[model samples]
Target: MGKPVLIIISGHPATGKTTFGKMISEELKIPLVSPDGIKEILWDNIGWKHDFTEWSNVGKVSFELMYYFIETCLAQGKSLVAEAHFHPEINNARLNALKDKYGCKLLQVHCKADKSVIEERFRQRMASDNFHPGHRHGIVEVYGEEKFYDKLGKGEKLLNIDGEVYEVDTTNAENIDSNKVLEFIKSNL
Candidate 1:
């Protein structure tokens, strides 16, 4: 069997990563892994808010763990698609290491559907995210969309730091050739 494709769909939780990831996984006939799903599967152990450390540290640890999970599946020659925020700043380094370690291919698919679509998605996600009353304090499953966009703008600053990294804006990225997205990946590869 051929080596499996390690596709990491990175975007905010509500931003169609799950939807697009599922679509790609189906099209490619690969196993789909969502960090959110993984989190939910181990929610009690991992907890909701990983506010213990800086963004990069927590993400680095999570990325390392996810890397192992994805790599194991890949080594078994199983195709896999990973869906999550996969924060670039923290996860990219480990991804690079994984690429070198296992000859694994890394495709960072940026899920950028429209804002309204994203808002709707998040609403549905928060509702089904196992929200409990009086369990966790200040646990509101709401996305600060504007804040997220603002943060994304800031994060883009780091993009140029790594020329090999692929970038795609899937905003209005459905029902057509997400060729720009593909081109972004092909160029990087």
Candidate 2:
């Protein structure tokens, strides 16, 4: 068996991080750790208010759970893909510490898209009934559309970790080079 690998998929909202991460995880047969998935579970069981502070707190807990799961997998010498809107200032140190402790190979796939596309996608997501209520209420309803759009327009803040970085332009989902992405992951691992 080879060394364990951590494939981190990160980007701003509506950048297709989750979609790309899911593809990678499926193709590579790696377990996926997603904070949003955890947050949805929490919202389902514990309940949530349509308030920013409440949503933020739930998000924090989701991150904690994601870290715990990642560490557990690493401890067992397992490779996995983790997807999140990772803040550099907050997550870089934590990820570095995990890498050091587990001696795992790290790789990051940073997804990016045009700002206008992101705004449109985000709006579509917000309006879609299929999406989790937490996102619709917590993000736009609580934070307001202008503030949320402003945040999205600021672009992604990627984690500062020593790793091979693959940037994917997701402006047009149909245009993403899945074969190239798979090749990058295969080469790294």
Candidate 3:
């Protein structure tokens, strides 16, 4: 009986964005919008990374589907929990445009852990995810927070889109618990 919410989770790969998004979505009883999972679904239907250069349409197709999926979710008057890097300008632009067009609110969560912690987590996750058909070992996963900070330096948009953001760095003693993230989300909502 409340207005719909659009909660977007954005961060670098292997930063546990999806996991956190899933948790928050379940906690808030909102539907989730997962672009990465979409990639997995369409993996066999399109080109893999090795073929990225050859078939530019592959990326376009993925984006288009993601767009449609978000639109559908919003039209249903349901809140959404979306996970993605969103470091890319293109993705930001798309979300910004869609926000205006659909009148959807966006809650951006930047999940952080120490660089070393992320790398170790990446190695652990890669043991399984690397074998996933659409996955490969990316340098960002190996570098973690360092790579994220570097991207921020290189001018990736750390947008407070819709003026809502929940920043969490597990390295900090204060954020050692997920309560910080939940509190931020509650305040924003």
Best by TM-score: 2
Give candidate 3's whole-model lDDT: 0.64
lDDT of 1 by residue, 98-159 (tens): 56666666666765555566666545644674543212221333323455434432333121
* Candidate with the larger TM-score of 2 and 3: 2
**Candidate 2: which pairs clash?**
none
TM-score ranking from best to worst?
A: 2, 3, 1
**Candidate 2, 1-189: lDDT as tens digits:** 388999999888889888888999999998999999999999889875646777788989899999999999999999999999999989999998899999998899998888999899988988888889877777757778777788884744677897899998899888988899889999999
lDDT leader: 2
Candidate 3 displacement at residue 4 in angstroms: 2.0
> Candidate 3's residue-wise lDDT over 1-189, tens digit each?
254567777765556687788888888887776756776667666545544343345446656776787788878776677776665556767777767877777778877666666566656665674545455422233334355445432334355565487776654444456777777777766
Model 1 spans > 4 angstroms off? 44-64, 113-154, 157-170, 173-189
**What lDDT does the true structure give each of the candidates?**
0.56, 0.88, 0.64
**TM-score for candidate 1, residues paired by index:** 0.62
Residue 89 CA error for candidate 3 (Å)? 1.7
lDDT over C-alpha atoms for residue 92 of model 3: 68
lDDT of 1: 0.56
lDDT of 1 at 95: 61
